[model samples]
Target: MVDRLEQSKALASDVRLTILTWLKTPALHFPHQVTGDPAEIGVCVTLLADTLRISQPTVSRHLEVLRRAGFLRVRRIGRWSFFARDEITLSDYAEWLRDTL
Candidate 1:
């Protein structure tokens, strides 16, 4: 289970929110990847960095937070990392919001 406080903190930033929003519909937000499917395998870290106009390390930091919060899942292919949203967790969080708020 995800820590509610951590999940809330993960959603606190505008940049993080944008990242989640883009990831929610990667095909619409990101370019066609060469290796894996965006929806299935996830978006590449390099692609996310380029799209966000941020350093890879910076993007990694944000991704780490979301990962810890259980909002994202990562897949390693060679030396590259791909990220996708945890839809079940997202739905749970939404339901949590509806119940709690």
Candidate 2:
């Protein structure tokens, strides 16, 4: 199970929230990817970094936080890493918030 506090902390950042929003609709927010489908395998860290105008390492750090919080699903394609929203966990978290709050 995902730790509620950790998940809350992950969502506390504006940048992290934006990243989640972008991942929610990657096709609209991101361009076509060659290696993997944006909606399937997820968006590349480099692409996210370019779009966010931040360093790749910085993006990776944010992604790591989300991943730890169970908000992200990661895929490794050769030398690259991709990230997408964990829909089930997201939905569960939303339901949890609705019930708890």
Candidate 3:
């Protein structure tokens, strides 16, 4: 779909890919992560901010863009909203990108 291409374009940046990579290895990139269960519980924006050395608001903005473009998903637990890559959508998108391009 055209929308998928647009979303792919949005994610073409290396920073976005780095973000995904960090999410894939939360414990390595981010300290204070529990010994187990970052993937299930998702990641906090503050941890992302500290790890990536980016401003909190800037990280939030990138996350918002990723969410809007369908590469990321959010889960709200009580007051905090955690984030993770949307593997289903991302997998399909990868296949689509390969097929299309």
2 or 3, greater by lDDT: 2
TM-score of 2: 0.95
Which of 2 and 3 is ahead in TM-score? 2
Residues 72-95 of candidate 1: C-alpha lDDT, one tens digit per residue: 999999999999999999999999
Q: What is the C-alpha RMSD of each candidate to the true structure, in Å?
A: 1.0, 0.9, 2.3
- Give the CA lDDT, 0 to 100, for residue 3 in model 1: 84
TM-scores, one per candidate = 0.95, 0.95, 0.84
What lDDT would candidate 1 get against the real structure?
Answer: 0.92
Model 3 lDDT on a 0 to 1 scale: 0.78
Worst 10 residues of 3 by lDDT: 28-37
Model 1 weakest lDDT span, ten residues long: 28-37
lDDT of 3 by residue, 1-101 (tens): 43875686668777777888888766666657653356777888777887788998988888888888888898877777678888887888889879978
Lowest-sum lDDT 10-residue window in model 2? 28-37
The runs of at least 3 residues in candidate 2 whose Cα sits more than 4 Å from the true structure, single-residue gaps closed, are: none
| Model 3 TM-score, 2 decimals | 0.84
